[model samples]
Target: MGLAVSGGPDSLALLLLAHAAMPGNIAVLSIDHGLRLEANNEVALVEGICLQLGVPFTGVRVDVGPGNVQAKARDARYAALARWAQEDGVGAIATAHHADDQAETLLMRLARGSGMAGLAGVRSWSSLPNSDIPLIRPLLWARKGELEALVGDAGILAVNDPSNSNRAFDRVRVRDHLAKHDWLDAEALASSAGHLAEGWRALEWYAELDWAEMVAPDPDAAVQPALQYCVNVPRTIQIETVCRIIAELGGRVTRSEAGRAADRLWRGNNASIGGVLAMAGVEKVAKVGVEMRVWRFSPEPPRNAH
Candidate 1:
């Protein structure tokens, strides 16, 4: 396994615990996102510790794309880590994502009016962004204070990132708010996020079943290919089914987009979303002995130039 270390208190404790448990089975990967001048020094701190522990270490530098510095940097970081893992023959990667992070994520998503999936927060086990490499969070159950104490007890000095204290960032703001609230239980909130994740998985499973039963391809194949979905199901199932069709038709649809598209289709109206066009119609279902509402999804055509 590969451990992602940032020389922060949480990740430093992660490195220590993982090395203690797995010994030589793990290697450390530190990504320099090129956003901070202190990033190289932080990576050096992690590297020094890795050397002292007799573990292999690699430092990777990545260029974050324009727009949304934090989001872009995260994407670049994970992409670089995935490439490093592939080259180093690592099967999986682990990161330090503890309960406090999970709680903040849940709160942030909630503030954004997120649905069940988005509100589920960061997953403990997921694939790297745009890659199939397995990513694991072995410290989801641990608290931030606990990890800090662990590093303190071991006499390990962790680097403090300035951005973490900057109120300009949403995460930092949330962290500050969480710190001020003595009544909020971050561990319980993390557990709630876990339960929501389970609910999301259940929704995905049901959506698959609905897709298998109520979806089909347009019979005429000479023109543009389209997917037809029977829309007589429940609203949640309809939204999930439409999401799958939109994704299959080469469009990325978010939960809110799917919900809106499903609503438009339910009213027998045409709607466009995520580069896909959803046209509502009716079909005679011999099996159901009735007329069924249907939605046909196809790629949106290029707009005519005036």
Candidate 2:
């Protein structure tokens, strides 16, 4: 198993506890996002800790481009971790996302008017996007203050990132706001996230069932890559089935787009989304009426007009 240690209180505590529990079987991975000069020194300090503990360590440097630094940095960090785990033949990557972090995440997504899946927040155990490598958050049920106390008890000095307290980020703002309210329960919020995750899993299961029954590839369509769906199901099932078909065709569509497409198709109108054109039509054969909605997906041709 590999542990992603950022030298923070939560992660450092996790590193110490995991090392003690699984001696000679744990490895450490630290990522230097190259965002600040102190990042290098932080990685060095973590590497030194690993060396002192006699654990194998590797440091990876990543470039984070502009626009939403937090989100981009997260994506880059996970991608790097996944690649390293694959190279090292590690099946799971564990990190120190605690109950407080999960509560903050749930609040942040709620502020953004997120759906159930988004409101599920940081999962205790899940896979990275587009990869099968598992991500485990063993300390997810632990509180941040408890972890900090554990670090102090162990006499371990950990590095704190300044950005964590910077109010410029939404997460930091949410964290600060939560700190001011003593009535709010982090454990309750985290438990709510877990319940929402279970609900999301049930929805995915039903979506798969609908996909199998109502959607299929249209091999005989005029377009090269297309999907055919029977619109005789409920509107929710229609949108879910359309989303699955679009993903299978290498096209992307959001929930809003799918809903809009369903509405337009019901009105006998054609809709285009993410390079996929959805057209509704009906054909009669052998005195029987057949209703079919064909969604044709193709890479958009280059356009000179801006």
Candidate 3:
């Protein structure tokens, strides 16, 4: 098993527990974002802990370019972990995202008006964008305080990340808001996330059936294989089908992006999303009292040379 450790209380607790549960079979992986002055020291501390525990340790330095720092940092962390997993032949990577994190994620996505997939929030297991290795969150049922208590009980001195309290981040804001609302149970919110995950899975199930029944590679296109889908179904089915097609092409399109693209196609307008072009046929057909929309998706052609 591969454990992602940051020397923080939650992650250190995970490290201790995982090492105890899977002794002699666990590897610890840590990523230094290069943004914090103490990041290198943190990685060193985690490495020393792993060394003391007799577990193999790998430390990676990641560059988080200008953008949403937290989001970009997360992307970089997953990319580094994926590379490490490939090199080590590890099947999965584990993180210590606990119940409090799950609640924060659900609230954040809810505030953003996210759909079921987004509201699912910090799944226990998911694949990173453009990666096949599974990312596992084993401590989703535990709270951050509980994990910190465990670290204290084990006599482990964990590093505190200052950015976690910085109000500039939306997650931090949500965490603070949740903290103020003492009556709101983080565990209940996390349970709602699990329920939403089930709903998302059901949507994917229907989308798969729709894909098998209506979607295919466009054989008539001059360029390489493009996607073609029979879009005579309901709007929800069309949107979900488009998402699936984009996912298949290694393009990650958000729900709103897919919905807008599908809407444009339904309106007989050509749309492009994530380098995937959707063209709607003007000549429509009516079958069984419903108007049929046939849309074809292909890679956007390169611009003409001057």
Candidate 4:
């Protein structure tokens, strides 16, 4: 496995500790976006650190100057990591994101009226399409404070990324606000998110049961087994069932919208999730079919995946 080293304090601490523990088992992968003049220097610093620790180092430079800087940079960084791992025949890719990042993600998604999936935050492991390789998070249980404290306890200096403090970013907004609340709220929020995720899982489990019994494969949207498998499920389990089916078939679902629509399946005669519209046609056999939302004839695998 490799650590994505940006010279940030938490990542640096993770790198140092991983080296101290695993020794030769781990290496550092640094990507320079060339956004600042000091970017390359930052990579050099991480490389020097790796050399001192007798760990191998590889550096990649990405051109992320167009489109959304943050989004494109993230895409490029992961793409480089995935490419390097594939070439090296590595089993996994490790990132520096910690519990704090997860918490912030949950909060942001919640503020946007996200459902359980968003609140669950990113999973610790992401399975690559048609590959056994996965993106793994070793620091999932660690917090930014713990990682920072590691650096301080070891008497090591780690560079701070100024972009983290900029309020222009939505993450910064959530992070800054999370900076003020008591641990009770933060921990409670996390706990609540966990509960929500559990609920989502349970709902999906029920949906799977329902689908097996009622749904059939569709070849066409207007014909049998044309595009996807169609199910005549009750409004009670519509969105969750749909989301579960989509996920199993390697597709994306809007959790928040879907959850809301599911909640309203009984109250309203019609509800739509991701353009998959459902109307109350029957209740006993749960005869409900989708009309618009998101439907693809065929879906492609995740690009630049592990």
Candidate 5:
């Protein structure tokens, strides 16, 4: 396993705790996003800690774009860390994402009306996509203050990322909100995100099964590369099924548009998703009818909105 150390108390403590638990089994890695002025010095501090601990260490300085800097830096950081683990033949990557981080992410997703996917929060363990590597988080039980205390007790000074304090960021805003309110209260925030995860899995099973029954292959479905599916598509289930199809291909659809589509299906009116699709042999069937089939396609097109 490899540990992703960012010189922050959370990750640094993770590195130390992991090593103390499994000596000689974990390697420490830090990615310098090069965003803040103190970033280089922070990398140096990480190196110093790794040296004193006799742990193998490496660093990467990334020039993430100014606009969307956080997103870009996060992407680049993960890419670099994953590449490092792969080169070192590490089987998994573990970090210090705790229960608080999970709560914050869930709240932010809730504000955006994020559905099941967002409500589920981060996974405790999962395999990297298209790779043999697994990602793990062991500090899910530790609070941020506890991690900080552990780091201080170890005589390691942590570099505070100012982004954590910035109110402009959604995470910071949500964190502040969670701090002010008692998240344990039922109405305070959805306490069921954990249970929502279970429901999400069950719903996913039903959605996939029902989608297969209601939808069919339509290569020439839409401009966005969706598939076509035939369905009896009861009036009550039309809107939900359309939303499901879009989501199945990782598309974000709004409730208003879903409602319009549903109303069309129930009223037996025409509905179009702005794509001229092809059927068994007939072409340009954007609107599904009684004998008409719904159009969908594979997600291969380049669209910015998605």
Candidate 6:
């Protein structure tokens, strides 16, 4: 296992626990996103701690692209970590995402009217972004305060990232609000997120079944393959099924995008989303002896060159 230590209280506590539990079997990996001047110092702190613990440490710098600094930094960090893990033949990577983080994520997504998956928040086990390497959060059930206490007891000084206190970030604002309110139970919220994650898994399973039963190939000899599906399932299932089809057609679509496309198709209108074109039509079902509504999803055609 590889531990992603960021020199923060949570991650440093994670490093301490993982080392205590696994000893020589665990390695430490850190990524400098190049967004903060303090990142190098943080990585150095982690490296120094790793040296004292007789654990191997590797740190790398990554470039974050434009647009959504936090999101891009996260993407770059995971990609770099995945690459490092692969090179080191590490089977899995563990990060310190505690219950407080999960609670904040749930609240953030809820404010945006997110669907089941988003409301589920950060999963305990997932894949690295665009990578098949296993990403595990061992601290998901732990609270942030507990981790900080653990680090404090261990006599380890953790890095305090100034950005964490910046209210300009939505997460920081949500964290501040949670901190100010004693009524809000972050642990309970995290548990709710876990339950939602299970529900989301069940929904995905049902969506797979719906896709197997209701969806079929268009049978048209076009450059891009198309999928046709009859509306036989419930609306939520229908949305999931359409999202799956859009993904299969090489279009990355969110649930909201799928829902909007489904709505347009229900109104006998064509909709385009994430490079996939959805068209609604009616077909005669000889077996049912009635006209059934059907939707076809295909890759959008290329625009004519200017």
Candidate 1: regions farther than 4 A off: 302-306
**Local accuracy of candidate 3 as per-residue lDDT tens digits, 61-129:** 999989889889988998898899999998788999999999999999899988777898988998866
| Rank ordering of all candidates by lDDT, starting from the highest | 6, 1, 3, 2, 5, 4
Best-matching candidate per lDDT: 6
For each candidate, what is the lDDT? 0.89, 0.83, 0.87, 0.69, 0.71, 0.90
lDDT of 4 by residue, 23-121 (tens): 899878899997888889899989988898888899989988588879888878877887888887766777776778778878889789765556677
Pairs of residues clashing in candidate 6? none
lDDT per residue, candidate 1, 60-135, as tens digits?
Answer: 8899999998999899989988999889999899999999999999999999988887987889899998889999
User: What are the runs in model 5 whose C-alpha is more than 4 Å off?
Assistant: 127-132, 182-191, 210-306
Per-residue CA lDDT of model 5 for 66-176, tens digit only, reads 677678887777778778888988878987887778778787787888766668876677765446678888876667889899999998789889899999898888888
Candidate 1, residue 117: the lDDT equals 78
Number of the top TM-score candidate:
1
| TM-score of each model, in listed order | 0.94, 0.89, 0.89, 0.74, 0.72, 0.92
Model 6, 222-294: lDDT tens per residue?
Answer: 6469888887677788889888888888888878888988888888999998898888999986656788888
Error of 6 at 296 (Å): 1.7
In candidate 3, which residue ranges exceed 4 Å CA deviation?
A: 221-224, 246-252, 268-270, 274-277, 281-291, 299-306
The per-candidate count of clashes, in order, stands at 0, 0, 0, 13, 9, 0
Any idea what lDDT model 5 has? 0.71
Global Cα lDDT for candidate 4: 0.69
Candidate 5 has its poorest 10 consecutive residues by lDDT at 274-283
- The TM-score that candidate 5 achieves is 0.72
Indicate the worst ten consecutive residues by lDDT in candidate 2: 283-292
Model 3 lDDT, full chain set: 0.87
Candidate 1 has its poorest 10 consecutive residues by lDDT at: 218-227
